[model samples]
Target: MPPNPTSYDTASEMAGGPGTLEGMKRLWTPAWIARHVAMVVLVVGFLCLGWWQVTRAASGNTLSFGYAIEWPVFAGFVVFVWWREVRHTLRGTRTERPTPAPSATAGSEPAAATAGVRRPVRVSRVPVPGDGVQDGDLAEYNRYLSWLNANPDAKPGDYPG
Candidate 1:
């Protein structure tokens, strides 16, 4: 009989196979633990800040500048960290798969892709009468027509209609 193939395949396909908890524990990697810890820290920090502010308001504080002052500083730090994490994610830091790099061959497709393609956007064109009225005046004219149509029994001199 042929020897059993190795359980592991590609880096992306690595997963906990059916076995004892010890085997699974070995696969519980440091990166995974760090991810979970980071998530918990973010959630807990947000909740604590919200709870503190609510408590402060309930305590009948005359002003809210204390929370406001610190909120921006805290928010800025979070935003900076999140941006770096996103950049790393886009760069595929965790995955072993290599992203396809642009080819050196000069072609229209590559040039268009790199230089960016411009799409023609359709804009609504309401033709204004050359001698009739300015485009801005059409709004008031529409209002008048709508009023007249709604109140057919009312005379022209009557309020609006």
Candidate 2:
């Protein structure tokens, strides 16, 4: 049964007009098509990897048995994320990331709730002091060098503690 035109439906009102298949055609754009093709290829590649791992496990290579189950799971996760993105894009809403709802830490904001643009992550590889090349051993090494500098008669193997 058709509803009366005066019915209050806030979502449809905000949608601006009847959501139709016209915008859904954007799903077939070249970039999206390529993404779909890549998704298919990734699934095939994962299946091949999983099969190879399974064959290895059958031949007494126990390590590959775990990997045999891993590849297909990765493929499934990729498809899930892709499906969500397609649905989100076709909704005709602003693609900017929605602000996270206020939490118990109410005043704090999420770091990168931008216009759907993600910031690149920076990875630092500096060695901390105490672990091998970090602090304590480095000081000990420096002390050994200084001790060698002072004790000219010491043999090269005679490192100071």
- Residue 112 in candidate 2 has what lDDT? 48
User: Among these predicted structures, which one has the highest lDDT?
Assistant: 2
lDDT of 2 at 46: 90
Per-prediction TM-score to the true structure, in the order listed:
0.29, 0.46
RMSD of each: 17.2, 11.8
For model 1, how does the per-residue alpha-carbon lDDT over 18-134 read when each residue is reduced to its tens digit?
243433453347974675477557756865775677678668874554773465557556657755664454334333555566675765354334347576799879864587656
Deviation of model 2 at 4, angstroms: 15
Candidate 2 segments exceeding 4 Å error: 1-19, 93-161
> What does candidate 2's lDDT look like per residue over 48-72, in tens digits?
9999999999999999999999998
Model-by-model lDDT, in order?
A: 0.59, 0.77
Give lDDT: candidate 2, residue 155. Answer: 93
Model 2, residue pairs in steric clash: 129-134, 129-135, 130-135
